[model samples]
Target: MRPDPEGLLPATEPVTLIDSDGAPVTPARAAVPPASELVAALGAMITARRFNDQAYALVRQGRLAVYPSSHGQEACQVAAARVLSDGDWLFPTYRDTAAVVARGVDPGQTLTLLSGEWHHGWDVATHRVAPLTTPLATQLPHAVGVAHAARLRGEDTVVLALCGDGGTSEGDFHEALNFAAVLRAPVVFLVQNNTFAISVPLSRQTAAPSLAHKGAGYGIPGQRVDGNDVAALLAVLGAAVDAARTGGGPQLVEAHTYRMQAHTNADDATRYRDDDEVAVWSRRDPVERLRTFLTRRGDVDEARLAAFADDAERLAARLRDELAADLRHDPSELFEHVYATPTPQLREQLAMLRDEATRDTPAGGSR
Candidate 1:
């Protein structure tokens, strides 16, 4: 059979294994992974949800400076982190704290950046995860660069870089994809199409039929998947990561999801979207769908599910207690990591800060 012309092809459908009602749309193929792995994925999603809830509560209580919740998008975060190996690197945006935690970083350390207490909460080299980037799409180019460097160094490394629908509009996003395609860099770009970027909906973000189609222009293959479906996300991301590790070059996966919470503690989502719309997506909750599937398959019983809930609660309690403690911030940390060697200006500034500290202290006592 002759293939149809490239541009005349139909739009790609979002890949899905299960329906919104928690029923399988097709048989679980051998590639679907073992039941034990799926159950662990579910556990990660539940833990992430609990962490997200506690982070938002901490923000309200003034324990955190700010938080960007990934309440409805836990599946994407968990799947992305689960697919990577220890040698692989992850480049996460400000909204990807869940992804960081899933990669085995301490939950408390993950929130340190948002709490405004430290530069990055965790060491990048030790974790193989980049610091959470607040600037839109900037991490894409960095991921590309690292992937390309690793290839030159004769190392088997894959890099997964994440961005939101709104971030796809940034110049760095385009440049990174173009470079990766040209260099055949081992990197995977995952764009979470969470319906809205802050108050701006996806409709205003671009006129393209779908975000995945953007990959075509850059000579990279793209696939769309149901972001809320943990099983589907795991299957698709696992394939993509494997392909990249095997010299498949760069690929893009756009996961369609919804942001159930306000953009942050400061913005109000009700101003732009109504309750009815949110109610619709709420029915497609990632955690509940997986739980229902597991229950039906006898992979998990009600007792086991209850135990998981208890575990999540204990995690939240620990995070809450850690955040409630009085922590000291060294003012000198500001100028410490700015440069490998301190510049004359930085030294002068450090001196000024020390002088100010001396003046603030009592003459006969230490601060």
Candidate 2:
């Protein structure tokens, strides 16, 4: 039976489980994961938020090249990582350091690229995580290829690709979605619609009702969930992941979240948006919303919450110490990962670079 195109489109009203007030907006529809999973998600969110804080601090101190803070969107960040299996792969954006950390990639190794140390920062095979892509939606096509290949091998491995709202505008985004739909690839596209693409707002990006609505154009099912509600995110994203893994084809999920901090350490959010708007979103903060909900339900006591905080602090301290250390990178590595088998031109360039490092290379003024 063919699915209805309109039915595949996301609802006008984003799905909401817990409201900003820590109450269920719709008790009937707010079916969350089990208690243990919710508790784990809460802990992960705490750690992720703390990780963002520490990374931003490193950026300010000039320890890193730059950092894209996932401060206010911890719900989707954590859910993206937690809803995957060990064999599944994650394709993260530059802003998804929090998601990578949640997936068990060592914090130091995860930050290696951002710290300007190495290109292949961590062995992707180690955690099945792709390199944190910074070139907009380029990773989308790569993810689709991987997921489609996995299907060909009869592997039930699912691939979750993260993208910002701005990335949806890229040509790769369209190509990937169309290819995934045609191939019936087992992939989930998680778009964190944080309202702004650096300085440009969503209004300027597209006139579509929601980012999720764009999925219908590619013949994929889509859903939109309140990104600040951890419960809602888990339910929505988990279902999407499950569907993709079971051969239900690709899924597109748009998380309506906000970026509390500047786009990156190098950006000034104050230039465009006002504080009043930020304050409005602050009331709908993911971390506080989850904490309030958990406390009210007796799922977490003061002791447990305090323990989560302590654990997060310890993790942040470790990352700080590692990032603060003096480090140097091998300059020759620039040409190493360019391709699997280098062409003659690349080989010649690699030789030239290596030879120059050994000799006193001519400066631009002399050359």
Best-matching candidate per lDDT: 2
Candidate 1 lDDT over 1-367, as tens digits, reads 2213363221467877766888886764415656898899988999999999999999989989999999999999999999999999999999999999999888889998888776778889998999999999999999999999999998989999999999999999999999998998999999999999899999999999899888878777788888998888999889989889998888899999999999999999989999999999999999988888878889998788788889889889988987897668677777888998889999999999999999999999989
- Cα deviation of 117, candidate 2, in Å: 2.3
> What is the C-alpha lDDT profile of model 2 across 307-363, one tens digit per residue?
999999999999988888877756656666788877789889878877887576566
What's model 1's TM-score?
0.95
Q: Each model's C-alpha lDDT? A: 0.90, 0.91
Q: What are the clash counts of all predictions, listed in order?
A: 0, 0
> Distance (Å) between predicted and true CA of 325, model 1?
2.6
Candidate 2, superposed: residue stretches over 4 Å from native: 339-367
Q: Estimate the overall C-alpha local distance difference test score of candidate 2.
A: 0.91
